[model samples]
Target: METVFLKKGEDRRLRIGHLWVFSNEIDTKRSPLGSFAPGQSVLVADCGGRPLGTGYVNPASLIAVRMVSRKADEVLDASLLHRRLSDALALRERMFRTPFYRLCHGEGDFLPGLVADRHGDHVVCQITTAGMDAHTDELLSVLDSLLHPSSILLDNNVASRDLEGLERFQRVASGDVPEEISVEENGMSYAVPLKNGQKTGWFYDQRVNRAALTPFVQAQQGCSVLDAFCYAGGFGALAAKNGAGKVTFMDASAHALSYAKRNAEQFGTETELLQGDALTLLADLRREGRTFDIVCLDPPAFIKRKKDAKQGLEAYQRVNEIGLDLVRPGGMLMTCSCSHHLEADALRGLVTRAAGKRRRHARLLFQGFQGPDHPIHPAMPETAYLKTFLFHLPE
Candidate 1:
């Protein structure tokens, strides 16, 4: 019932259905941000008194308001939350044979700041924004009604929570889930560490991208593979499955290497697991005269914010150079960047620059992105973050 007014000529983007309202665009003189509490629902409008839509206000965040609905009367109540959860669940049900994919992809699923990753009967839900954080119980109620899953996890420990004026903690909302859970991805099963593993215990976004590496590995039956920053061997496991004769995985976490070893042994592949920094391992491998027919540089996002663009690009530059050095002439180079701040073409450009510096030419073969489970919002570029590219390095 409260109203938040935007500055003069600041509602054009909203008119085109864009969902975010930045703090600077608000008119403090007329409708002050201090007037509303964080995560409070408000009817957003243009300075001319024209209603734009309904959204949640977060004065503390740079993203001041996240529009949840375009209708003036719409309220993000239990009913609306139920419908959104059901709609997302229905899509996942139609997409996967088992309920193991990302059920809700934040704004991509039209529910900004909310994520739910389904692991069989156990579902892990993450709330990143103050708006969504306030509605945690309502969101959990919807999930319970829709799936009646064995357990629900509130995986809310992320840095973004701090920016949204929220506290981070992981707690069970229903039933009981374990510290470690089993997951199946692209025909490979992994015993994911739920208590400590990265991002919802799995990176389901790379599902299709890893599957795309199958034929490439199959073509080189006796070739070697180096999965750098390979957390639990998502790509390496696939390469082994596709008949890569020798596979090497490198990760900073010894715990993750243990899981990778388990997966490699299960597949009966010749595998080597190295526990150390990926960049350091790459240097040591080069020093030890190691080269692979295939190298996958699937490192974590180097760029988290816009201001870090310069530093992130430099980090990517260094990593790509190291990855290229590890790849044999005529080998395959698959590199990825999950920073939404960097576009796909820019990733290709970084790879090209790295290759050019080393006199290695890159013949780009394929471009990949997050799987269907992580849908991209056309209106929000932030939703389209994952970028993967397969290149052939010239001799």
Candidate 2:
């Protein structure tokens, strides 16, 4: 009901489809920051009092306002949330064979700061912003009205909430959430803990990328396969099932290795799980002169922020070199980075540099991206984050 008048030229970004409004762009003279509370809906207007849209306000954060609707009269309420949730659900139902996938991808779904990962009858929802956090009850009601899920677990234990001056906590919004849930991807079922697993129980974005490794693994039957930073052995298990032999999984988490072993055994395949720092393990493997026919480097974001670019780029180069060293001549390399700041070209360039250092020629097999569950917003380049590249290195 309140109005947020932007500075004379501050509406340019909004006009270009950008949804964020920084604290500095507000016309504080006309609209005092202290007058509005966090998560409070307000009408956004231009310099001449022309209505731009509607969104929620967060005075304590740098991204003071996030546009929720482009329509001048659209309000932030249950009706709006229902439409967004329904639209997100409709698209996922059409794309996936089952209900297990990312149901809502925050800003990508136009519901900024809210994410929902659907695990069949159970759903894990995360609200990272003051706006969505304020509508917890309404969101749960709407979700129940649509899918009528058995459980709606609110996994709000993320660091980003702190930036908005909001404390983080996790609880079941409705119904009882089991400790572990089964999610099927690419015809294989994986058990992930709802409360303890990383990033909404599983990295559904890499589902397609894992499938991409199958044909390559099928081509090299009974060949050695290495999965670096292999959490739960998604790539390794898929490769093994597709005919890769002597599969090895490396991860820092002993618990993750346990799950990885289970997933491998479930498919009647024997896997060697190594627990340690990935880089150190790679160094030790290289010292032992071990090589693999297929290598997957699916590491976490080396570059989380812009300031970490220099160091992160160096780390990417080092990891690629280690992965290349572990791959036999003419072997395949599946390298992925979830860092939004790392561009596809930059990742390829790093791989090229690593191969050049060894005097090996690199041939790109194919470029892969996150599955359709994680849709990209045309206006937000940041939404297009995941990059998976399959390469062949010739000695």
Candidate 3:
């Protein structure tokens, strides 16, 4: 393999276990990036020519190299993919009784740019980077061998693919893609639209956080819930399964609300489905003096890129302010942020400030994160993205 030498001192993060190598860090004098083809596997080395590891290089992307293995000779092949799948599956099996969790979590599972979420006998994989996209066949073979999944859906329609200079499209790699798939979580069943659904059809990362809502729902008699940004009604379904008296499903997408309504129907829970912008609907609800026993705010990433941090924080504050306003005295508020740019401390502080604006006493009941399936790489903070906070408003 050709060698891609990093500038002196640029190998520090990689040596400490980070998987990404920025474009500017490369020693272009020794190994010009333009000379290598996209997704070309290369041996990374320091300026002195000492080998660092093996990874695939993408000349067009900011993350020029994503190290696959620490060994110089190791390559991302069928053997390596098989071993990584086995290890990731082993951990998930130990953590969950059902085969309904994220099987591969990009860099978290040490397989950068590849995410595979298993939904029963079906596995939906997202290959975001050109490097992983080049190994689609090997990935499919490894997944099939490991799980024998009836279908392997490739949901490559993501914005990140554009950054990698890869075309975005969705296709079934193995068996015929099903219209929908069912999976049990927190003793509740959800009908996930695998083909047209968002983000692998389900967000398994929020599994633990959704499960944490049981006790809160059970403790309140005739509980009312507002599942804001309710995708497929995961949160509202859980509340309904636990005997919530009234559950409102709200989202901007009519497509998402269709499945959320179906899931609610399956749960035999009478729900009010509101289709509109979350902020607008939330404000209307507040104006109508509508209050609930539990209000869940699981909005999409407000801060996608670093530059959007300021505007995203303001957006978060506005939405959360309305969320807090809709919570009655002695009620619960569950808010979440999937933005890696927004830290847990910042979320907590923002929520605190939101509550203070109403002169309400807020007690943080629980702090939650992505489930074990979405393991956080010790050296990569980006891997630990999801943050959840459950707060109680005292009377």
Q: Pick the candidate with the highest lDDT.
A: 3
Model 1: per-residue Cα lDDT over 274-392, one tens digit each: 88877777888888878899999998899999899999988898898878888988999999999999899998998898888888878999899999999998877888999999999
Candidate 1 structure, TM-score to reference: 0.97
* Evaluation by lDDT, superior candidate among 1 and 3: 3
Flag clash pairs in model 2. Answer: none
| The best candidate in terms of TM-score | 3
* Ten contiguous residues with the weakest lDDT in model 3: 261-270
Better of 2 and 3 by TM-score: 3
**What is the C-alpha local distance difference test score of each model?**
0.88, 0.89, 0.92
The TM-score of predicted model 3 comes to 0.98
| Whole-structure CA lDDT of model 3 | 0.92
Of the two candidates 1 and 2, the one with more favorable lDDT, higher being better, is 2
TM per prediction: 0.97, 0.97, 0.98
Structure candidate 1, residue pairs in collision: none
Q: What lDDT does model 1 reach?
A: 0.88
Model 3: per-residue lDDT, tens digit, 1-395?
99999999998999999999999999998899999999999999998998889999999999999999999999888899999899999999998899999999999999999999989899999999988888999998888888998999999999999999999999989998999889788887888888989999999888889989889898885699999999999899888888888789999999889888888777677889999998999999999999998999999999999999999999999988999989999999999999999999999998899888889999998999999999999999999999999999999
